[model samples]
Target: MRELTFENVTVRFGSRRRGTVAVDDVSLRVPAGQVVGLVGESGSGKSTLARAAVGLAPLASGRISPAPHERHVQMVFQDPYSALDPRMSVGESIAEAGRRAVDVAGLLELVGLPGDRAGDRPHLLSGGQRQRVALARALAGDPEVIIADEITSALDVSIQGAVLNVVRELQRRMNLTMLFISHNLAVVRYVSDIVAVMKDGRIVEYGPVDEVLGDPRHEYTRELLAAVPRPAH
Candidate 1:
C-alpha cells in the first residue's frame, strides 16, 4: 500500500489572466490503506485534483507524490463506456494495464465478476458490470492509489450500492489507498473514512466522515448536506 500526497497544489486552465483556477492551493494527504472522499458540486475543482493525482491534468504549482511501488496511479472514470474500448474483450481491456502476469479470470473475480465474463465485450454487459470491469482494469497494474471519479453517478441506485460495496470490500481486503470523488455527500459518507468538502476550488471543510458531515462548520458544507434527499421514515 502507498500513500498519495498533494502539497500546496494549484491548477489553472487557459492563460493566467484569462484562465480559470480549477484547484487553488490545495493540500491533502491520502494515507496508505484508507479511502479519502473529495466532495463538491460541479466546477468545485474536486475532479481537477483527482486528475492531478492521476497525472491527467497539469498542475500550475505544488506537487503530487504517488506510492513507491506504483509506476503510476490509476483512475476509474465516470463513464466506463468511454473509458473502455468497445471492440476489446473485458479481459483484453484489463490486460492493457500491462499486468499480463495476472490472469484474466483472476482480474474478473477481483471486481466481483465471474471469471467467464472476461471474454465479453463492454457493450454486452450492463452499466454496473462495465464499471466493475473498469475497476478490474484499474487494479491490473497493482497501483498504490486508485482515483475513482464520480464512478457511480451514471448507475441506478441499486447498482450504485452494489458497486460501492465492491469498492469498500476491495479497499479493506487489498489495503488499497483510494481517492473517491463525488458530489453526493451521502455516498461519500457511506464509503469514506475521511471527507473533504470543496467550494470555489478550495477545501472548506475536512475531517472524519461523521465529524465533517454531521457537524459541518462551513456554510457551503451545511448547504450541501441539506440538499441531499432524505428518506422519510
Candidate 2:
C-alpha cells in the first residue's frame, strides 16, 4: 500500500504581493510500483511538483503524504554534473546518499557501469555515464519513490534511449514509485504507466498513459500531442 498522495497542494514562491504560484491546488495520486509521468512545456510546473514531492519545495498550502515505507525519497536531476560532486569519487557520492557503507561496485553494476569507474570523478565520465552514476546514487538511498526531473533532456539522442532503458529496468526490478518529469511527450509515453499533464500549475489531463495520450480529451493535451515531432514516411 505504499503510495504518494498530494491533497490540494499549492506551492508559491517569493513575497505574497509579487509571489509566483508554482503548483496551484493540485491533487494527484501515485500508487506504489507505478511510474507516473508529469509532462508539460517549460514553466508549466512539472518540475516544481516533482521537487515538492521530495520536500525540495515548500508547500504554501495542502499536504504531500509519503507512504510509511517511503522514509527517503530521492531525486535524479537533469544535470548530473551539478547534482554530483566534482571532487568526490563516484563511489563516495553514492555512499553519501546511502548514509551507510554501501557496495559501490554492486551499485555500479546495477546501473550498467563498470566497477572500476567507481573511483572516477564526475567530470571524467561522459554525459551518459555521469547520468548513470547519478541514478546509482539515487538508488543508493533505497528509496520508495524516485523523482526524475528531465533526466534525459541533457543527453544526446542516441544516449537518451540507453539511459531510459536503465531507468525502466530498474523501476520494474525495484518496484519503484516514480514521478518522471519531462517536456518530451514521447519519452513520457514510453516510461509512464499513468500520465498527468500539467499546464500553468494545474493538471489539465490525467489517466492511464494510453488513454490520456492516445485519446486526449483536453484541448491542451490534444495540442501537446499534435505538437510532437513525427518522422515523415
lDDT of 2 by residue, 1-233 (tens): 26778899999999888999999999998889999999999999988888888777889998888822355678899986688889899989999989677899999999999988988988899999999999999988878888899999989999999999999999998899888999999999999999999999999898999999999999999999999999999
Q: How many backbone clashes does candidate 2 have?
A: 0
Over 1-233, each residue of candidate 1 has an lDDT whose tens digit, in order, gives 88889899999999999999999999998889999999999999988898888777898999889732346688999986798999998889888886557777987898899999988888999999999999999899878889999999999888999999999999999999999999998889889999998899998888999999888899999999899998999
lDDT of 2 at 21: 98
In model 2, state the lDDT of residue 157. Answer: 96
Pairing residues by index, what is the TM-score of model 2? 0.96
Check candidate 1 and list the clashing pairs.
none
In angstroms, the error of model 1 at 140 is: 0.2
Stretches of candidate 2 off by over 4 Å are 67-71
* Model 1 TM-score (2 dp): 0.96
